[model samples]
Target: MKTDSTDDPRTDVQTASDPCQTNRDHVEYVGMHVDDRPVVLNLTEHERLAPDRSLDLIRQSRPGFEWGDTGSGSAQLACGLLLDYTDDEAVASQHYIQFRDDVVSQLECSGPANCWHLTGDDIEAALASVTGHEALTPDGGTPTPSLPVNWSAVNRSERTVFQRRDIDHYVVLGEGTEEWLLLLCAQGDRAYPAPLDIRTVPIEEDPAPAVRELVAESNDLVEPEENA
Candidate 1:
């Protein structure tokens, strides 16, 4: 799956490959982070389709458009968020709540800009909050699930899996409030540091109301669906 980023308003989509077609599919991802944690938000069109060659045409028009500052990198762009915890559950909880709510709201409501997926530990706590469930970890903190609990959102199909492995940015931020260490995820493996530019977003002070609503609605929705 190939993703394209818009200049002003960002959008996110997940496209799969098409066997009958001879082109690669295109999708967009917009990721937001509070402090370091990230949330796995909306994924559009999670089906295998033919790739749009227009993306390539846009680049060909501009000279050196495909190159980064180094002038010798692929056009692919990836993003990630990192959080620093004193190993304090309370602090981690605070960061997790805000990050989770932001992602959930984005998922429920259509975002005007593209939304990115949260792929690291900071957002894990938030996912736990939304699902109203907890995972047991041997270490003091909860364990990060190897895969996302929400199947449809994460694993759309084999086509999505192929793109997730092929091209994606993994960015890691530092531990401080506004600092982020950069990381990269290539070809479906875990993320590591990358030479790409890192973008750090500020964390919110208190996200109590958003957290409450997310948990309440999630719990309310899941019960009937499960029972039904």
Candidate 2:
């Protein structure tokens, strides 16, 4: 269930010639696929704005979002309201399909719809402002990191942030009965590679506090580093 973060194209820039290749500039995205490639809604512009009540809060700041006729439906899904429980299934199903198609069309018109397509330097600036974690490529999106000096890190070899490997939303995304009705990924999308993994990697959870508790207990949860 847990996919390696390094498998992601955006996070994994390493090559056979450059294993130590550091992540240069990562722009976080909340997107889906179009035409067998990733069609991203680059969220770099809306880094300052929180998705409190509405995804609409950041639509204007997005890199390129074509608010087509079905744009309102996409917005509705993003805000966690697809349809009422009492609403008829046939109508909801039809609406859902149309909304996803509109998103795909809009994405294609926005820019080159590719997974590794970096938006530009402007996005990098926005990322620089919000990336709180030290390790960027694979860990830039990690919500929290333990203090290096903390005792919980006694077992750690290199400085590392806990990778967010848990993803529950995909289960919901695939489920026809889930409250959230946005079909961000199709069945084909899951087979591509690490983009699905990267998208699912949970970024919101903070691991520092729990790790701190283990430190207090003198429990080294991880293998100790070999002495240099």
Superposed on all Cα atoms, the candidates' RMSDs to the truth, in angstroms, are 22.7, 22.5
lDDT tens digits by residue: candidate 2, 21-45: 3334543333433333323333443
Off by over 4 Å in 2: 12-50, 53-73, 76-104, 108-228
User: Which 10 consecutive residues of model 1 have the lowest summed lDDT?
Assistant: 71-80
lDDT of 1 at 115: 34
Give residue 154's lDDT in candidate 2 (0 to 100): 16
In model 2, the Cα lDDT at residue 71 comes to: 47
The TM-score, computed over Cα atoms with residue i paired to residue i, of candidate 1 is 0.20
Each candidate's TM vs. the true structure? 0.20, 0.20
By summed lDDT, the worst window of 10 consecutive residues in model 2 runs over 167-176
